[model samples]
Target chain A: MFRKYRKKSPWILHYNAGSCNGCDIEILAALAPKYDLERFGVINTGNPKQSDIFLVTGPVTFRSRERLVELYTQMPEPKVVIALGSCTCTGGVFRDMYNVEDGIDRYIPVDVYVPGCAASPELLIDGVVKALEILEEKTKAIEKPFRLFKEASSENGIINRRHSALKVGEKDEED
Target chain B: MSKKTIHIPLGSQHISLLEPVRFKFECENEKIVGVDSDVGFVHRGIERACTTKFKFDAIGYVVARVCGLCAITHSLSYTVAIEKLLGGEISKKAKYLRILLLELDRIHSHMLCLSHTCENAGFEAMFMRIMGDRELVMEIQELLTGNRIQFDYISIGGVNRDLDVQTAKKIIENLALVKAKVFSYIDEFTNNWSLSLKFKGIGALTLEDAYRFNAIGPLARACGLPIDVRNEIEYLPFDEVGFKMQTHNDGDINARNMVRLNEILNSLEMCENILRGLPEGEIFTKLKGKPKGEALMRFEAPRGELMYYVKGDGSAMLNRVRIKTPTFACIPAFSHIFMGEEYADAPAILASFDPCLSCTAK
Candidate 1:
């Protein structure tokens, strides 16, 4: 029940891993009146634990790597990560610099990548929409039952724990 | 009764902060007594890369990524420095166009800062209104430069794009609308009661402290120091466009807001002046030869004075690129202003300073 509602409204937490202010401002513009990203039921939150989407910008710098990882870990399960710039996706211009760690994917798993020197608001809105689909899929995967027994009394009226655990979900039938 | 002090920390990642900047504050009761700031989170070693990874001509684009808000000022300063070393003169039309884009950049940047300030002061509606109106300036910027943010219009010796009559008409129309909106903001900033509670007489830096701390840009100008790079730099024709310095004596958050608002009006006027009498000449002039010696260039970014020191060894790759950003220069004054203010007002006060952590760290 909560999973269905989770897709309706997903709060986002924005973290600048080491970006120029361009992408950051664009993110704000996405939320502003012109873009009105909030019309899609998205809100920018400060608390990581309450957030369902993580919008990470910039090429991850050495000093910000720890905080970036910590923020990713703090977010609840079924969360989606969107890398919001070319530098955040592949270290665009800051690649091979002394301080940057190439891209953010080196530190955290990314679900969607929005590529631009400074990602435009249109691209950001599109990225968030794609993330909502991913978030829904992850939610469904998490809620699925681990196994279903064929019969309650099998193998001399004893519960077959091994057999029941062996058939994981419904996909094992094809396998 | 004994007096005790408590320690409070804000940011690295606070909701109020747009960037990653950490500040540890020591408070006695409701009053903040001391502040310790960390601005190195956004540092990406661009200074080191400027000399090693990129050549002289490409460095202009590379430096623009240093701070998105002041990308034009950064590239313009670096290009002007290279022009000085190569000893070439750009056409007057190109100079006028450069000033046009620079002023447009300032208008949008200042609007962003003002809206952010309103958001921090707990006025979300005003934040939305200002941001909505700010799109007018952004539309004009995109019409002129082909991008909303990070316009790479500037190149060495000249600008990359030329102005057209259609775009010029649109820019004037937008500027007039932005000008009228700014006047309404001036009234609200001065007379609004809720804003006055958060901004007026709160987080003030006296004139003596501004001079002592070596504050620059609006922070210094708000306190009546009258320090502006546009007034001093000979590389651009600021005087011809009727550039006027805006200052206030109150030195508080309200004064800073007023100063930025007034500057936006002045910048709008300057843009109109440039478009009205734009000289007729080629936009781009191809210059030959590598930069042989060192040159220093300075420009008035929206925040403060941006200085670029470029040293070339007469090769394709230069020696060093040193960037002295405005926010980095005013850190001392920022810390000083927090003293004796209520801890609750910290975010609003900090917003008024318009600290660009990316610029400072880079």
Candidate 2:
């Protein structure tokens, strides 16, 4: 019951890793009335714990790398990550810059990549739409029950570290 | 009796800030006394990249990456400096087109700053209203320059594209709409009682403080100091294009808003005039030979004065390319204005200054 309502309202946390503010403004423009991404119930929240999706822009600078990881970890389980802009996707123009870390994917897993010099509002909206789907999938995966596996040597029924039955992308049929 | 001072740090990452700028404020009973700012978070070594990675001709587009809001100004200033070093003269039409885009850029940037100021002051409706109307200018920029944020329109010799009649009409239509919105905003910013409480006499910067700290752009203009780069630069023909300087006397948040609004009006007039009487000539001029000597170019970016100092060695690689961005220059003034203000008004004060950390750190 809570899952259906939660899917409708996914708050976003925007972090400027090391961008030129092109993507930052584009994100704002997407939220503004012209594009109206908020009509889909997306809120640009600042708190990490309350956010369900992360919209990160710019190349991951050396200084922001730690903060990026911290923010990602702070978000609750079953969250989606969207890398907006060319620079954020593959470090586009700022690639090979000494201080830049190529992209945010190096530090956090990205579910969607919105590619553009500044990622136009249309592209950003598309990426967010794609992210909503991924968020739903992750939520379902988290809710699925799993059976613990027994170790050959350990006495308890706790899942063995090496022989755990719950693989991330492995389908239920794999069992 | 002296009260105990408390230390408060705002951001390295905060919702109020669009960029990563940290300020450690020393406050005595809700009154801020001292401010220490760290603006290096967005530094990606663009200066190093300019000298080591990009070549002379390509550096124009590369420098445009310095700040997205003033990307055209960055490229135009660098391209002009390179042209000066190479002894190349661009056509008259190209000059007018460059000013058209530059003024449009100024209009968008000021709108963003004003809307951001409203957001910081807890005026969500005002913020959204300004942002929604700002799209009109952004649409004009897209129609004219082909891209919204990073329009690499100005090449070394001239511009990359020419203005068409349809785009000209679109720009005129949009500018009229934007002008009306800006007028309403001016009235709201002045007459709205709640806004006046938040803005008037808050984050006040006196003319003396503006001079002592050497504030630039709207900040200095608000203090009634007449120091606009457009007035000084002759190569760009800002005067011929109907460019006017907007200055106010109070030097508070309200005064800065007035300066920005007036400047937007002037820029709209300049844009309309450029389209109306645009010269029929070549959009670009082909220049020969490599840049050998040193050249400095200064232009009025939306924020303030943007200076580009380039030293060429008659080679593909440049010797030194120094960009003195306006926000970086006003770091002293920004800190000075924060002193003695109420701690609660810190965000609004910071926003009204229109601080660009990406430009500053770059």
**How do the residues A53-89 of candidate 2 rate in per-residue lDDT, one tens digit apiece?**
9989889888989989999999998899999888898
DockQ of each: 0.81, 0.74
Query: How well does candidate 1 score on lDDT at residue A123?
Result: 96
| Deviating ranges (above 4 Å) for candidate 2 | A150-175
* Recovery fraction of native interface contacts for candidate 2: 0.67
C-alpha displacement of B146 in model 1, angstroms?
Answer: 1.3
For model 2, state the Cα shift of residue A122 in Å.
0.7
* Model 1 C-alpha lDDT per residue in residues B178-208, reported as the tens digit of each score: 9999999999999999889889999899999
Each prediction's RMSD over C-alphas, in Å, is: 2.1, 2.5
- Predicted candidate 2 versus true structure: per-residue lDDT over B143-178, tens digit per residue: 887888999898989999888889899889999999
Best-fitting candidate, scored by DockQ: 1
* Residue B246 displacement in candidate 1 (angstroms): 0.7
lDDT of 2 at B315: 91
